[model samples]
Structure formats: C-alpha cells, structure tokens
Target: MEKITSNQNSRVKDWKRMQTKKGRVKSGQYVIEGWHIVDEAIRHRQTIKELMVVDESYLGALPVDDTTQVFIITPEIAKHISSTETPQGVFAVLDTQDYHEKIPDELQGAWLLLDNIQDPGNIGTMVRTADAAGLDGIVFGKGSADIYNPKVVRSMQGSQFHMKLFTGDILDWMAAFQNAGIKTYGTELNDQAVSYDTVKPTSQFALVMGNEGNGVDPEILEKTDQNLYIPMKGEAESLNVAVATGILLFKFVK
Candidate 1:
C-alpha cells in the first residue's frame, strides 16, 4: 500500500480534480467518498481504480483485489479530497461508465428522462426514487445536472449502482421509444395535458421531468405522446422536482 501525506502530492491533485465535471471528463474517472457508496461500488462490480483512506484500520475486509491500488491518506488529504463538512476518511476513485455507446439496440421498460434539471440534490433524489420504483434506467438529457457530481453521488445513497443511467438527446430517446412501441409522457400543464391519474400505469414508458424553474421544454413536450399534470388541491403552486418525480414514477410502475 502507498501512503500520501501531502495535499500537494501529484496524485492528490488529480483526485481533487475529479470533483469537477471537466476534470472527470478529462480523466475519465470520478471520486466517491464514504463507506456505503464505496461498498456499493464493490458489490456492484464497478471498476474501482484506487482506494484512499485515512487509516489502514478502515480497510477491513474490503473485497478489492490486487488490481486496485490502495493509498493511505492523512486526514488533511482526506479533507482536501472531500466535499462535505466532515470527511468520511474513506474515498474511492472509479472509472466513469460510458453508457452512451452501450444503449441497447431496442430500448425497453420504464425510463425516467431528465430535461435540463440543474440541482444535484434533485437529480440524486429522482435517481434513488427511480431505483426504488424499479425503473429500468434513467436518461440524462443535454442540460441536466452531471450524474457524477460529488454531491449528486452522495445524495443518491448508492442507488446509482442499482440502475442503468444514460446520457443523450431527449428527442432521440423519444424517437427510440416510439420505434419500440413504448409511449413517452411529458410533465406539463398546457391545455392539451391531462391529469397524471387519468393514464393507466404500464410496464414500459418514458416519463420526462423538466427543469426546476421551467417545466419541460416546449419542443420536447410537443414530441411526447401525451402530457401529464399533477392536480394540486392545496394552495401549493408546485412540487419540488424530486418530490413530483417520486409521485409520478410510483404511479407509472405496475
């Protein structure tokens, strides 16, 4: 095992860079902190390139093989790499999985499509909800938050490992679903939209959730087979994107 005590170490600087979208893209890797997520990565058989912990004692029984490099980082190094108030003292660097090229020839099953969502928390919540709702996968459209964002990864609570995630044009996905004989629903409140409960839940469909301030893109909604709205009886004008997603996803699944 290697030891790194200096925050200025060349490798430490590389790990810090993983915190940003551009850096993650350039390196083709991202860093995940905390034991739960790390364990999830291991159990899910993700390609873990390296493990960094403050103490050797914290390395108890991890299933990493000899191919995975282990580094003993000082608490200062942990703080340098962590984004939270208190560092979990455990971190793992994983190669980013590129699903763009791996998209199935024929897309099937329920999928959650995010359109221009910007909040890491909201993105993470919807992902966890989709996983809990047993959706086949999630497609991150062009303007959605970065899935590998550290905050998003932590907020997902490891549910990311349980589901397929993809990135692509929402319109393309809509077309693919159409070709597969699956319907696409966009969340909106236009005159042509109907209440969400009006539609019957099915085994396969695509649900699009829009931006926090703006709803689904007009063009995207125009392409959807139907548009849905959640009726509100209370004075509340709207639901948080994440909360609304959970409600709609559960309704769409059998």
Candidate 2:
C-alpha cells in the first residue's frame, strides 16, 4: 500500500482529470466511485489499475487479491477527485481499453440502440434496464452521452460490466442488423407509428431509442422495419426517454 496525503500529488492530479471526456480518452482510463461499483468491478475481474481510498479504515474492506495496487490518500485529495456531492472515500481507476470489446461478426439476439440520446441519467438507466431485460447488446450512436461520464456511471450502478456496449454510427448498424435478418424497430410518435402492442416479442430484435426531445431521426425511422409508439392515454405529451425505453425493453423481453 502507498500513502498520498497531498492534493498536489501527480496521481491525484491525473485522477482529477478523468472527470472529463478528453482526459479519459487521453489516459485510456476512467474513475469508478463508491463501494458498489468497485465491488462489481472486482466481481467482473475488470482490469483495475489501482484502488484509491481516503482513509486506512477502508483497507480491510478491499478485495482480498494482493495483486492490485492500493493507495491511501487524504480526505482533501479524495474530495478533489470525487465528482459526487458527498465523496464515497473509495474509488478505482479502470482501464477503458479493457472494456473495449470487439463487435460481433454477426448482430443477433435482442439489442438496444440509442441515437443521440444526450442525457447521462437517461443513458445510464437505459443501459441498466437493458441488462435487466437480458438484451444482447447496446449501441450508442454518434452525439449520445459519453458512457464514462460520472453521472452516467453512477446511474448504471455497475450494470455496464454485465452487458456488451458499443459505439458507432447506429444507422449503419441498423442496416447490418437488417441484413442479418434481425427486426429493427424505432420509437416514434407519428401517425405512421403503430402501437407497440401490435408487434410480437421475439428472441432476436433491435430497438432504437432516440433523442429525448426530437424522437428518432426521421431518416432512421424510415429505415426501420416498424416505427412503434406506446399508447400514452394521459395528458402528458411524452415519456422520459429512459422510462419509455424500460417499457419497450420489458415488452420485448416478455
């Protein structure tokens, strides 16, 4: 174990930089905060470069594996690196390179696609929901929220470790899924969109969710096998993207 009491320490400075997308990309790593997330990382055997704690009190609670480097730091340094309102005093630096999985040669099984979904919470919740629904893969289209954003990571609650996540031009992927004979459905609220109930759930499918305000891109909708919408039956004009995704995901799962 190592001790770091100063906020000016080089490692602490690097950890602080991880809060931004550019920094994460440059370093090829991201910070995972709190015990729950760290536990999940350990469970998944993620390539954790290091474990950092603000106090020695947490030492006993760390993973039994002696191979991981653990560092004790001052509370001030922890506060400086933590993104939450209240610091958890525990965190891990995980290599982003380790999480980059190869896209399957064939796109099959249930999948979820996000097109320019900007909200971090919505993105994270959707990922968690997809994992719960046993979706095979998730694709984040261009302009979507960064998967490693602190808020998104916290909301995912470590479910990202359990699912396959990819990033690319979702429109291109749609064509690939279609070529493989996978049914791709996009959510839209226009008259051309049919009620979700009209479509029967299948073992192999792809659901495309769009930006919160604009809905699915018109062009993408046109390319889908079916444009589907949930019957609101309420005064509210729309559903939060995450909630709507949950409903559609479970529908397909059932």
Candidate 3:
C-alpha cells in the first residue's frame, strides 16, 4: 500500500474531482466509502481500482486479502477525500461501469419507477426501501437524479449494489414492460385515485413515483395502466416523497 500524504498528489486531486457529477462521468469513476459498501462491491464482484484506508482504526477492522491495488493514507487525507460531514475513515475510486448492476430476471414481480424524481437523498432512500420491500429494479427517466451520486450511495446504505438499477429513457421500458402483460401503476392524488391498500396489485406490476412538487407528469400518467393514492387522514395535505414512497411501496411489495 502506497502512502498518500500530500493533498496536491495527483490521486488526491482526482479524488477531489469526484465530488462533482461531470468529473465522475468524465473519468468513468466515482468514490465509494465505508466498509459496508466496499464489502458489497467485493461480494458482487465489482471492479475496485483503488482502496484508500485511513489510520489504525479501520486498519484493524477491515479484512485484508486480495486488494490488488491499494493505497494507505491518514485520517486527514481521508477527510479530504470524503463528501460527508463525518468521514467514514476510508474511501475508494471505483470504476462505475464495473459496478453497474445487471437487469434482474424477475423484472415483473414488483417494479419501482421514478418519473423525473430528482432528489438524490429521496432517490437513494426510495431505492433502499424498494430493495427492503423486495421490489424489482428501479427504472430512471432522463430527468431523474443520478444514482451514482456519492450522497445517494450513502443514503442507500449499500442497497444500491444489491438491487437492479437501470438508467435511461423510461418510456420505452414502461411500454415494453406493459406489453409483456405486467400491470403498471402510478400515484396520483385525485378522486379517481383509489387508496393504495384498497387496490389489489397483480403479482407483476410497476409502481411509479413522480416529481417531488409537480407529482407524476401528465404524459406518463396518461399512459399508466392504473393510478392509486395514499390515503391521508390528518391535516397534512401529502407526505414527503420518500415517506409516501415507503408507505406505498410496502403495500404491493408483499
């Protein structure tokens, strides 16, 4: 393991560039921190270009074996590499293409769709919930948040590596999935929108979420096979996008 002490070091500079989306894309690499996510990457056989360890605490805790290319750095250096408030004591520059997930065989069981939902934290939490609820992959449209964002990865708690994730235009995917006899549903707050629990979802279906403020777009809503709403009895008009997603996802997931 080579020691990285200077912030001016080329590797340190590259890690800092990963703080932005363009940099991640330009280099085809992103930063993955913490033990859980890295372990998940190894378990999934994802390509890890470099592992940066900070100090003795992690040095004792992390399993040492086949770190083909590794680097050692101090906690201060780790902090410089981290994006979070409290540094996780380790960081890595991972090849994004190597970490992309394969489309699951069970694309029909329960699918979660995001239609232009752009919040990184919300996207991550929703993906985490969908994984926890045993839902199928999440399909992202053009305007949706990038799942490769560092914050999204942290918010997902390594669930990102476990679930099937697809990024591209959603219209074609939706059309194809529906054509295959899989029912597709979107959430809308309306008179015609029945309570989520009241509706009986098919074994194979897609649950669609929309933009945080505007809700589902009119075009996609028009195309969906069904529309449902989460019933709110309290004074609050609606739930936070993430919370609402959790409630609605758990219903059809089981």
Pairs of residues clashing in candidate 3: none
Estimate, for each residue in 51-73, the C-alpha lDDT of model 1 and write its tens digit: 99999988885779789999999
RMSD of each: 1.2, 1.5, 2.4
Q: Which stretches of candidate 3 lie over 4 Å from their true place?
A: 64-67, 98-107
TM-scores for all candidates: the values are: 0.96, 0.96, 0.91
Residues 80-115, candidate 2: write the lDDT tens digits. 999888888999998875433445777779999999
2 or 3, which is superior by TM-score? 2
For model 3, residues 100-127, the per-residue Cα lDDT tens digits are: 3344443567888888888889988988
Off by over 4 Å in 2: 98-103
The numbered model that scores best in lDDT is 1
Q: With candidate 2 superimposed using the best TM-score fit, by how many Å does residue 34's alpha carbon deviate from the native?
A: 0.7
Minimum summed lDDT over a 10-residue window in model 1 is located at: 97-106
Q: Which stretches of candidate 1 lie over 4 Å from their true place?
A: 99-103
Q: Which of the two, 1 or 3, has more lDDT?
A: 1
